[model samples]
Target: MQASTLAALKELALQCARSAGELSLKRMKEPFTVEYKTSASDLVTAVDKEVEKHVISMILKRFPDHGILGEESTFAQDPAQFETLWVIDPIDGTTNYVHQQINFSVSIAVYHKGEGLVGVVYDPSRDELFYAVKGEGAYLNDRPLHLDRIVSLEEALLCTSVFWNKRAEQMGIDLIVKKLAGKVRGMRLLGSAALEMAYVAAGRLDGYVSLSLNAWDFGAGRILVEEAGGRVTTMTGTPLPYNEKSSVMACNPTFYEELQQYLHVAENTQTD
Candidate 1:
């Protein structure tokens, strides 16, 4: 994509993210209906759907032909149909949004044929906006975000999500978590993958891992981390597909190699 076009998309994503975030923040203060999707632990609120609709309308108003792949209301399950696609997670941490009313975020990203062009993640609680235009670098609010390298895992502060299911067991998340928690400087479970990945981009966290996530969950975050000079891939060390569910691991170059080795060890041991 041309630089100008990419910039335009970035601006649109930023606007949509901020607007959706503001709406969600405002609604969070009020009572809203909540429902479960897969289980009681998995939640969705009216605000999530409302914010997604608001964002979709805003994007379509500007670019009617563009496709929208949203968490609440997905237009297309397969993203290959659209030349330009907007991937949105209106409220990334729904449990946080519903219960704690914090740690949640609005995530938005634009892609052209599987290549990320614009990424925006907005945290309404902190009033922080982390954004990136491909080749333009990343920023948190107004400040540039460039991650500094960490030499070793023992010195690294990392975060991860552990969902309870067969997938988690199959991924050997139990072993991975136990190993990393003992090895890293500290471990955290932030509830929001996008926010955690943003923290990794800002160098606030050295790395992040998750056994399962959809495209919308990490769409904006993957771009932010990469633009900030970090690397993101599946836990198995494969490139993430444009709009599919997969595992995620994000960190700097040094951590990628170091962490991947540990990940392989856990997976190999699980198989053995």
Candidate 2:
């Protein structure tokens, strides 16, 4: 795609994210209904669905032919079928939104033929917007985001997601967290994958890892971190599949190899 087209998509993503953020902020103040998807801890609120509906309507108004993959409503059979695909998560930290009322965000990303073109993650409570355009750069609000520090594994502050189950996979994740905590400066679980990844791009966190995430969960975040001069891949250091659920690791380039080694050890040892 042309640079001008990519810029246009980026602007659209920004508009969608900001508008969705405003809606979420407005709805959060009122008492809304909530339901569980998998467990009590895994929740979906009426506001989540409402916000997604509002965002998708905005996108279709601008680009009626574009395909949409959204967390609350639509899921295309194959994103590759469309020349342009929009992946959206209206409320990324739904649990945080329902409980803490902070730390959640609206995430939107545009992809052309499976390649990311633009991304925007907006936190309404903080009024912070993180955006990136392919080949351009990442930014937090008005400031450009680049990981300038050379942080080692020992000095890195990391964020992660914990599985509530006690299955072998959960054991493996626990092992990884235990090992990383021993070596890294600290660890946190922010309950919102998009915000956590945006934080990494903003240099607020040195790294973020999750054993599993859907495309909508990390679409915008992956682009944000990469455009901000960081590395993003699976825990095994392979390319992240654009349309599948998979592990994600977003981190400063300086400490990627070191962290991957720990992931390797935990994956090999704890699962078996």
Question: lDDT of each prediction vs. the true structure?
Answer: 0.87, 0.87
- Cα lDDT of model 1 by residue, 59-153, tens digit: 98999889989988746445567889999999999999988889999999998888998899999999999998888889999799998665588
> Candidate 2's error at 42, in angstroms?
1.1
Count clashing residue pairs per candidate: 0, 0
By summed lDDT, the worst window of 10 consecutive residues in model 2 runs over 162-171
User: Which digits, one per residue and each the tens of the lDDT, describe model 2 over residues 11-40?
Assistant: 889999999999999998899999999889
TM for candidate 1 is 0.94
RMSD of each: 2.3, 2.1
TM-score of each: 0.94, 0.94
TM-score of 2: 0.94
Please identify model 1 stretches exceeding 4 Å from their true place.
74-79, 163-166, 266-272
